[model samples]
Target: MPIHIKADMAASVWKVLVEPGDQVAENQQLVILESMKMEIPVVSFSAGVVITVVASEGSSVLEGDVLVTLSDDGETG
Candidate 1:
């Protein structure tokens, strides 16, 4: 199974901390979003390997937009 990390609101991507093939733990920061002059950290929901990054740094994202995909470690195809 794959988990999607989505933007909670419209914002500019400040940074991407993890890339494809990187291992991430649950509640770990995946990316940072700048909105209203505030920086928000986007965290992962499950422990897994990063499969893809849909949003890049300096990119603007809307609410509910997918940021990254994670391949769950315990899941099987």
Candidate 2:
């Protein structure tokens, strides 16, 4: 099954750490968001392969927005 990464709060995307196809470990930082003068990191909950990154730097995102997707084996299809 695939895992969806969502924004926890409304913020501007600060940075994307991994691109699609990158192998990631559990708790790896995927992106950082800037909100209310604070930086928030979005992390993976388990080891997996990045499937997609829907967020770009400088993009504004709202809470619950889907930012990225990952699979346990790194395959999207």
Candidate 3:
């Protein structure tokens, strides 16, 4: 199964911690978003191998924007 991680709110992407082909665990921080002077960490919901990273640092992202994709079976995208 594949999972798509999305932004929960509109904000500037402050940092990205995962990349394609990286292994990620459940609740691991994938990206950080900055909004209204607050920093928010975006975490993974389940363990998986990252397939893609779409968010970039310093870019504005809207709510529900896809930030990362993951393959739960350890497959590379």
Candidate 4:
């Protein structure tokens, strides 16, 4: 299975903290978003290897938009 990380709100991507094949822990910051003059860290919901990033730096993403995908890695069923 795969885990999809989505943006919580509409914002411009400030930075991408991880790359494809990078290992990430649960709750790890994946991408940073800038909105309302504040920086928001988009977190990973599962601990696994990042398979893909759907958005890039300086791109605008809306709520519910897929940001990255992670392999399940047996962390959860």
TM-score, every prediction: 0.92, 0.93, 0.97, 0.91
**Model 3 agreement with the true structure over 9-36: per-residue lDDT tens digits:** 9999999999899999999999999999
Model 1 lDDT per residue over 1-77, tens place: 78888999999999999988888899999999999999999999889998889989999999999999988974322
Which candidate achieves the best lDDT against the true structure?
A: 3
- Residue pairs in collision within model 3: none
Q: Find the 10 residues in a row with the least total lDDT in model 4.
A: 68-77
Q: Rank the candidates by TM-score, best first.
A: 3, 2, 1, 4
RMSD of 3: 0.6
For candidate 1, the clash count comes to: 0
What ranges in model 4 sit over 4 Å off? 74-77
Off by over 4 Å in 3: none
Winner on lDDT between 2 and 3 is 3
Q: What lDDT score belongs to each candidate, Candidate 1 first?
A: 0.91, 0.92, 0.96, 0.89
lDDT of candidate 1 vs native? Answer: 0.91
Summarize candidate 2's per-residue lDDT along 1-77 as a digit string, tens digits: 88889999999999999988899999999999999889999999989988899999999999999998999866765
Clashes of each: 0, 0, 0, 0
lDDT-based ranking: 3, 2, 1, 4
TM-score of 4: 0.91
Evaluation by TM-score, superior candidate among 3 and 4: 3
After superposing candidate 2 on the true structure, give the runs of residues whose Cα lies further than 4 Å from its correct spot. none
True-structure RMSD, every candidate: 1.9, 1.0, 0.6, 3.1
* lDDT (Cα, 0-100) at 34 in candidate 1: 99
Q: Which candidate do you rate higher for lDDT, 1 or 2?
A: 2
User: How high is the lDDT of residue 77 in model 1?
Assistant: 26
